[model samples]
Target: MHIRRRRAVGRHDASDYGLRGAEDGAGADHPDLADRRHQADHPPGVAQVAPWLKAYFTPAEHHSPEMKEALRLSDELVAKLIANDHVVIATPIYNYHLPAVLRAWIDHIVRKGLTLGFDGKGLLHGKTSTVLMASGGIYTDGSPIRDRDIATQYLRLILKVMGINDVTIIAAGGAKGVDLSRVTREAFLERLDSEIELAGA
Candidate 1:
């Protein structure tokens, strides 16, 4: 199966952490994953979503020249989703939720008659997804702030809406230690290696 990885981080950071681990575990050299055609190296531009929303709500505008141009990137993003069998989303939590760029990418992909159906059904079926999230605080079981794990919760709901019900979430919590110099990035990532490998497998 072809795997497409969408990451909401800079190229350097994306390669430095969980995304790279997942890629390696999934066999980066494998033919299906080797072709980077469907991978989104960086998050989409957040500013462009405004025009996309306008065109999305106005069905008549979909065929218009201006609207077509506005929706080009969104279409491409959705096309990638449709093409891949497995989707891996690597993102860092921002304020207990998705980063602005990742949210914009989500907005562009949840298109009616494309990824979603006109009858309130999802068009993207038989696809699976994995979300690799790095957060500053622990939000898993036993964590007092578990309810604030909105990023993971939101992603699960949205993926289900898009017809990807079989989803795996790898939560790499307490990542702020790397930023604070309390732990090296490599060491922090090592702790979640098994989880990342399992998800990729």
Candidate 2:
């Protein structure tokens, strides 16, 4: 449910989201490499599924489509996750909640009878997930207009729907007003370093 200030790419493009291909084709198939197969033999930590992270700081290769097309392509993230790796999402909160792109990605990944299906016991289960969010304001508890980080709550529900109940959040706020002339960007980078270390542990 955390919102990262940075945008995420769903193995489609590095940046820029625009849903252009709505009526183009619906059943066209992606490559076999694009398919997410559960490989139990692989060790944990050897695999992971953070679409944006894979392309972090890299040059944008292409632009994502708009609307439903963008959501459809975001399924690549789920494909990467099928290998049974812990997930860490970096995103931003917009309009007091997660960005539409993030929601779009959620729609792509949370599949029925795939990510979550009733077992013989009628229970559900899936992978683990986490989120890192950045915001412009300092309201950790949020305001009347804002739902006090409703993004995090919604993310939990997303994971819950997929039977992935293990989730964590790290929030960064008021980053825009920082005194870059004084402490500089190193300080912020250090915080990210520590966060990555802790998450890796």
lDDT of each: 0.68, 0.46
Each candidate's TM vs. the true structure? 0.78, 0.53
Model 2 regions more than 4 Å off: 1-77, 118-126, 141-147, 179-183
Q: For residues 163-198, write the lDDT of model 2, one tens digit per residue.
A: 667776666555444433433444644565555456
Per-residue error for 30 in candidate 1, Å, reads 5.3
Query: How much does each candidate deviate from the true structure in C-alpha RMSD?
Result: 4.9, 15.1
True lDDT of residue 31, candidate 2: 27
lDDT of 2: 0.46
